[model samples]
Target: MTIHSISARRANRSAEARVADQGWRELASELNNHGCAVMEKLLSPEECAGIAALYPHEEHFRSHVHMARHGFGKGEYRYFRYPLPDLIGALRTALYPRLAEVANDWNERLGLAQRYPADHAAFLKQCHDNGQTRPTPLLLQYGPGDFNCLHQDLYGDLAFPLQVAILLSEPGRDFTGGEFVLTEQRPRMQSRAEVVPLTQGDAVVFAVHNRPVQGTKGHYRVNLRHGVSRLRSGMRHTVGIIFHDAK
Candidate 1:
């Protein structure tokens, strides 16, 4: 990339962070009400493509997963290394405080004793203290006939309640039928399936494990798992920002 391109990307990211700052309240409201929220066009198309391009470079990743080998699904993904990409790191930093506030509120409602720190660094320090030193940010790639199994992104003992996944490939043009799928399981009710709509540069923020729901007597916990439907054609790529580190 040229210096001008790099500068443009930085400006784009700055603008994106501003958007997150302004929209966080609405986003939190959606999370409290629906357990998920979509932030549209958080990244520019060039930025998205830039991120996806990084996936092929082995030095940027600490580990790779063939989802089928682990029964995770049919696609593949790679966990980022110690030094995350500039864009990813900025996103993790910019978005954490807002999500932390939502997470703290949920903890109170659910009667959970643990409260998260206000910033990502402190929370990460806590994770590292608990021996969760592996970075969990990842890039996932899906091809035709590939899919992801429904699952939570919780890494270790300490997990952030919310996580974000940004679509790096155009839905209709770059891939087909690989929709973002989320499932919610209430205590005594049948699971509800939600298909999230996302285009290139869009991001979906959701509960990483469980969310609190209002019940007749009190707040109850509902489990959530997210995945992708099988792609009918072409290739897809996504950037997952999992706040917690792995063991």
Candidate 2:
């Protein structure tokens, strides 16, 4: 076989690997019903540990944020710089098109005109053109008594509808009392909260700001915010993949 043929076959396999996963259809259905879906063991324990280990390396990140200083809660997080780590960059590229399909569907249901492009690079170009050039992927760390405030991940005008967070530390072994929490605010109704269960290497994809919810009359938009409950003991680590760039 020619070298070009082998390369083409490899590329096709990569593309197929991204979208042909068994769980994607189920994930979409769950997102349509609930504003969030969990992808269990998206990474292996070794991969999770490798990512969490990057948290202490200053060269990998662009900026560090102290949550208390910004009134964002108690923990700390660091935004990754450009040229993301290979696994993260690959995951970001692989996951976007799948989520974009669901995002476009939600936009149509909510009567919004915006549509996401099928690929991550094109969507990123759109963000960069609008002056949002900073990468949004981040590593977050939490210790005893630490927590994150409920907030949307919107960084600018061109926010992607969905974002993902992967738990890098084992819950029962590495932490306790720190739970992933999400809240939904419906019009003329009380806010509802959801506690997402995650283990090491597990990921949860959820609304970044708003999502369409079905009602008696038609689909309505519901505001969403996610955070972490206070940690009572030990430590925890997580990685966030936000498709849109920050200004």
Candidate 3:
């Protein structure tokens, strides 16, 4: 099988099983080692479908011009904001609670949860003391022939080091060309990037910044630079969740 196939297979496994199967620990170790890690199928198929159902296709999704030069280019790209109520409304009462639970569990495992209750308390307290607040989630939709640039999602003073995306389109079905690429290895200027083509019901998690070295006041974070390969045909829909301090 191809590397992508292997990665996809690894990602498609059960989250709990993956965690127990050494992959989760390996992923966490990689994040600790390289400042980033990419995991697939962070969400269940049912949950992914529920999220897609709530995605508003008719509502206007603002084109992200802020990083157009980076590779976003100019075509059809839209953004959607999500509030807690909206999430509950979209996913329905029955599913919202479970989804929230899953989100919290994921956050805790990824070390993004508030620290006071955990080992990262000092860091969490520092962020709160520094005026960082929670950030809202958003949905990104790319239409046929659309694309986006590679840039970071830096908002406010909150130190949001993780970002996630839920795939709503089926590969080779609802879309054919949009692929998520990340700079892997090489010099900063000539870094080799990896493309992660996802299918419906797939979820990806990645770190937004690098951990700080010793003596640093804060972690050295980079904007999680990412973008879609041109969508040759069909539409691509994704739900992005960015966790941050409440403003």
Candidate 4:
């Protein structure tokens, strides 16, 4: 790509981000009340397709995992290499600061010792210093009957509390039956299941491992795991943004 092209794209992304930033306060409120929150059409359809099209490009990814082989489910995904795509990287950079505040608040509420840095770059540097240098952002693809198992994206010693997944394909048109699923486990309580609604270019910000929940006594920790249901028809593609790195 030409230097001018790159510069223009960056400018465009910055402009769009200014708009997204307006929703942060509301998003934070929703996340605190619910374990997850859906942001509508965070990316344009063309941008969504641009990301999905990268799934088959071997040069962009460092590693691929077959979910069935690892008992993770029936689909597959590939982790981005050191240099993520422009859009993916931009999304990560734009989303992190807002999320860090919520994460830190959760940490305080749960009395956790670790605190997130003010920005994504600083947090990533900490990960790198700890020998967790692998990029964790990934592209997932699923076809008929394919699904993802419930799990957290805790790759290394360090883990960010929040992560996001953007749906690249339109539901009902590009695929059906597969829904974003989040399960929360509360102490001595039955697991609660939530199927998040999403559309193409839409994204859901959710807890990576755990979140704080209010109880009669006080705030307590509740474990969270995310996955996808079976795809009844067509194919599905999603972009997962994980702020932390892997060992």
TM-score of each: 0.94, 0.93, 0.58, 0.95
Model 3 lDDT tens row, 2-50 = 9755644444344334334335556555555543445565456666666
What is the C-alpha lDDT profile of model 1 across 1-247, one tens digit per residue?
9985686578648955665655777888889888999998888899999999998899999999999999999999999997788778778877888889999999999999999998889999999999999999999999999999999988888899999999999988998999999999998889999999999999999999999999999998999999999999999999999999999
- Name the regions of candidate 1 deviating beyond 4 angstroms: 1-16, 19-21
lDDT of each: 0.91, 0.91, 0.52, 0.90
Q: What local lDDT does model 4 show for residue 224?
A: 93
When sorted by TM-score, best at the front, the candidate numbers are 4, 1, 2, 3
Q: Which sections of candidate 4 miss by over 4 Å?
A: 1-12, 15-19
Q: Candidate 2: minimum summed lDDT over ten consecutive residues — where?
A: 10-19
Cα lDDT for residue 182, model 3? Answer: 62
Candidate 4 on 153-243: residue-level lDDT in tens? 9998899999999999999899989999999998898999999989998899999998998888888989999999999999999999999
Runs of candidate 3 with Cα error greater than 4 angstroms are: 1-23, 32-38, 57-134, 184-189, 211-224, 245-247
User: How many Å off is the CA of 8 in candidate 3?
Assistant: 30
Error of 3 at 124 (Å): 8.1
lDDT of 2 by residue, 1-247 (tens): 9975565555456545744664888999988887899988787898889989999899999999999999999999999998787778778888898899999999999999999999999999999999999999999999999999999999999999999999999988999989999999999999999999999988999999988888999999999999999999999999999999999
lDDT of 4 at 127: 95
